[model samples]
Target: MSSFEIYGGKKLKGELTVQGAKNEALQVLCAPLLTAEKVTISNIPDIVDVNKLIDLLQTMGVKIEKVERGTYVFQAKEIDLSYLETEDFKKRAGSLRGSIMIVGPLLARFGKGFIPKPGGDKIGRRRLDTHFDGFALLGAKFNYDAGEHFYSIEAKKLKGTYIHLDEASVTGTANIIMAAVLAEGTTTFYNAACEPYIQQLCKMLNSMGAKISGISSNLLTIEGVKELGGCYHRILPDMIEIGSFIGLAAMTQSEITIKDVSWENLGVIPNTFKRLGIKLERRGDDIFVPAQDSYEIDTFIDGSILTIYDAPWPGFTPDLLSIILVVATQAKGSVLIHQKMFESRLFFTDKLIDMGAQIILCDPHRATVIGLGRQHKLRGIQMTSPDIRAGVSLLIAALSAEGKSVIHNIEQIDRGYQDIDIRLRNIGADIRRIN
Candidate 1:
């Protein structure tokens, strides 16, 4: 476990480049495993989640060569199927949630995929029913060895069919698409997740010769091809990180410019921040957020208090609700932060409430923040990070607080953010990583 020590009340300045999308990178990294040819990927974020996926691939005998800091070439020339049953493989596979994605590619190319129950941040019940259901819909036999506690799917040959997902699962759709692209005939996915990350995965697969249609929509059609060839793919900018930065600038009253933000892809994220009354300027490809002393929340059409909630793609991402809740802490008005996707995500509001912010944790799913109007600065205190998004939210709070703050178990933060402390320091953030 690691910790972050921060001396509070520093208004940061200068610029920070948003890292490549961690979510998209995780999906695209698994695409190459569907082919034996070499695949080149650029703009790869060096985060724990992505690196852990890369390591999983390496353990399965995928050849990966680094082209540069954010570039790599991967070739799945050979894979050890038997290695998947090893204790070493099961232990490592269970460590990362993204490792579940390997199931689709392996089942597509080798007719079988195996994994121990996957692990990730214990935010809520992230069900794999959508994943296995999609695979079963694609003509794969789903099986679980209760004695070994292993889940697997196998098929003599995958044939495409119509699948209406129980939920619009992002990773589940990606896994199904990966499997479908190599199956016979066409596959239709209704109620599909249309997030930018999923769209990027579709495009990367198309470049690799997978025929996918209805991108950026809830309904998708995939024309299965005999095989997919390797191609170069670059990931999109991380929207979660950009949202965190927006909250950072507003919370710390800092003038900061976010570089190479991929403005076209951010959907409703920028506008969501504007609803918090933060001043944001779109400078070409970058977003310049000016320092703010006080900002007020906007009400709904019926004069109700502002409510921020999450939905499927092309909507507000649930990942940023933590940041939004933190930023609203110092705003001039009240707003209800609704995290409908995950049950335990909003539980960390207790820590924010402990730090002198007026917050009411209505339940495991919602919190209402009564803004302090910047009349009083928060006095920092020691706290442990409950999860990745909450960790960054606490960091933002600590940065704007009046005293020192200590955050333990920051490895949760490291899993998604790439060199976050270093990047923040480049823009005048007073934070340090310590053992």
Candidate 2:
């Protein structure tokens, strides 16, 4: 139970190189299980969730060697399937949301996969039906144990078929694609998630001899291969972290440069910030956000209030809505944040209201923020982090507020952002981690 003690009302100015994408790392770390040859990966973020997945893979007998910081080589030769029956395996796999992905590769190569109920941020109801349902459509038999809260799937051989997903779930689409790559026939996935993470996964699989098309579209076609080989893959910079930094700069009036952001993959993130009247420049592959005393929120063309909502990729990401809400607190106008995917994510706004931000929690799914235009500075107060995104959002608010603030449960932030307090300290922020 560590906490962050922050001295607020100071600007942070420095260069931050974004880490590798956390979501992509989770999906692609399981790719090694699809082959026995060595698969090398670089630019891996040193975070809790990713490390947990690596430990789980090592426990399952995947030979993993660290080439250097943020680089690793994994070979899934002679994986121990019997480990899946152990109590240790259950505890490990059940605690990680990313563990659900390994089931697909196991089923594709070994004809069976077993897992306990996976766990992650308690944001809302994230159903596993999409993952298992996609597997069932690919000729796998699915079973659920209500008493033990476990799931198991097995198949003699998978034959590819058409799958129209109920939702364009990112992880569900990644799991299904991993399984379909080794199936017997052509697999057509309709309404699949086409985020950069998914696109990278498909590109990685294609490099490994899997036939996949429609890299950046909802319709994906895959021709099953006999087997996959190994390849070296580099992950993209985390867009969520980049967006968070942009918000941090606007709220605290800091000039910060984020390096090598992979601009093309950012989608609508930059324009979304610009819509809030925050000024940022594109210097090559880097994003430079200038210091600002105040920013204004944009309204719709017909003179309606600006309403920002989350949708599938190419739209605003739900992960950054928390940052947007906090940034709006200091802006010159009002905006509505609609968190459509998760019902409980906006609940953290209560903490912001305590810090003197004018926010109306209209419901579980929406919040309306009226910017103070720096008319009154937010006063720091004690708070606790609810989840990863919300935790960072609170940290941003505390940094821009007046006086001292203590934030407990900083472990939530560490799960996603690596060495966050240390990074802030390097950028002239008065943040200290207390154990």
Model 1: residues >4 Å from true position, as ranges?
Answer: none
* All candidates: TM-score: 0.99, 0.99
- In order, the Cα lDDT scores of the candidates are 0.92, 0.96
- Report the error of model 2 at residue 283, Å: 0.5
Residue pair clashes in candidate 2: none
lDDT of 1 by residue, 1-435 (tens): 789999989989999899999889888899999999999999999999899999999999999999899999999999999999899999999999998899999999999999999999889999889999999988899999888879989999999999999899999989998999999999988999999989989999999999999999999999999998989988899999999999999999999999999999999999999999999999999999998878999999898999999999888999999999999999999999989999999988888888899999998998999999898778889999988899899999999999899999999999889999999899888899999
Off by more than 4 A, model 2: none
How many Å off is the CA of 22 in candidate 2? 0.5
User: Residue 114, candidate 1: how far off, in angstroms?
Assistant: 0.4
How much does candidate 1 score in TM-score?
A: 0.99
Residue 97 local lDDT, model 1: 90
lDDT of 2 by residue, 127-176 (tens): 99999999999999999999988999999999999999999999999999
Q: Report RMSD for candidate 1.
A: 0.9
Q: Tell me how many clashing residue pairs each candidate has.
A: 0, 0
